[model samples]
Target: MTAVRVLLADDEHLIRGALAALLALEDDLVVVAEAASGAEALAMARAHRPDVAVLDLQMPGGPDGVKVATSLRDELPSCRTMIVTSHGRPGHLKRALSAGVRGFVPKTVSAQRLAEIIRAVHAGNRYVDPELAADAISAGDSPLTAREAEVLEFAADGAPIAEIAERASLSQGTVRNYLSAAAAKLGAENRHTAVRLARERGWV
Candidate 1:
């Protein structure tokens, strides 16, 4: 049987090394390339055209793993993508699914599970970490509008309402409305708490 070609992309050296070692033990898998950053990952993907690409969500580049996955899906449709990261943020999952990644595995998952997920994605199946899948479903219950998300992001950075309004090009009242809407959606009592929660969930 032919071995499955795989590419690995992650920023941390030790984590990448550990993953490489774990994947090497799989009889049907071959690690064809390794990348330390999103840019390097993109270049390596273009060069190697591996059967599967395991990506770290946060990396150095203009766009993160989701964008890389989307690009690969568009330019190299045969190459599958799986996102592996420590962050199991709902927004990350939402964005990754939209980008066409076939699998999502958090760093906390065991190496055995990670390998299984990679192979599953390569074999044309979808995989989502059980913990994250539950969170993602719950996260979908409360939706934040794009405007509200923008205001919250600005507010999280210590921007005042006036500054946020100016930055978002909305009236002060409109900014307050957005913040209020976000607070209500998040079940928070105030804008500060809303911002904190949004930040924690990676909405901003």
Candidate 2:
């Protein structure tokens, strides 16, 4: 049987090393390359043309993992991709699916399970962590309005209401109104809570 060539990409050194070790144990899997950033991952993928590429959603460089996956899908059609990240945000899942990634695995999942997911994706099957899938479905059910989402995204950075208002090109009163509406829609007690909930639900 032919071995599966794999390229692993993640920002953290320890996590990358541990994942490489875990995947190395798989008799049919070969770690062809490792990347510490999105740019490096893309370069390595292009160079090695691995059977599977494991990417982290958040990484340094202009294009993220989703963008890298999209490129790989277009440029190396035979290479499959799996997104591994600590963030299980619904937006991230949506983006990964849209980018044509074959699998989505949360960082919290066991390394053995991650290897299974990689193999599954390489075999042309789709995989989504059960917990993330549930969160995505729930987020779809309770969608946020476009304006509300914008406000919450700005708020997440600890931006003051006035600053948010100015950046969003709205009056202070308008900003407050948007925040109140978003809070109510999210069943949150305050704007901060609303922002947190929105992010968790992938509204922002």
Error of 2 at 11 (Å): 1.1
Model 2, backbone clash pairs (residues 3+ apart or across chains), number: 0
Where does candidate 2 clash, by residue pair?
A: none
Error at 60, model 2, angstroms: 5.0
Give the least accurate 10-residue stretch of model 1, judged by summed lDDT. Answer: 134-143
Q: Could you tell me how far off, in angstroms, the CA of residue 114 lies in candidate 2 after the best superposition?
A: 2.3
Candidate 2 — which residues are off by over 4 angstroms?
Answer: 60-63
**What C-alpha root-mean-square deviation, in Å, does candidate 2 show against the real structure?**
2.3
Please write out the lDDT profile of model 1 over residues 1-204, one tens digit for every residue: 898999999988998988899989998888999999888888999999999999999987566888889999998999999998887998788889989999998899888888888889988999988889888787664479888888888888778889999988889999999999999998899999998888667677
Question: What lDDT score goes with residue 99 in model 2?
Answer: 85
Q: Which stretches in model 1 have alpha-carbon errors above 4 Å?
A: none
lDDT of 2 by residue, 1-204 (tens): 898999999988998998899889989899999999988998999899999999988887667789899999899999999899887888789888988998998889887888888888988999998899988887774457788788788888888998999889999998899899999998999999998887777667
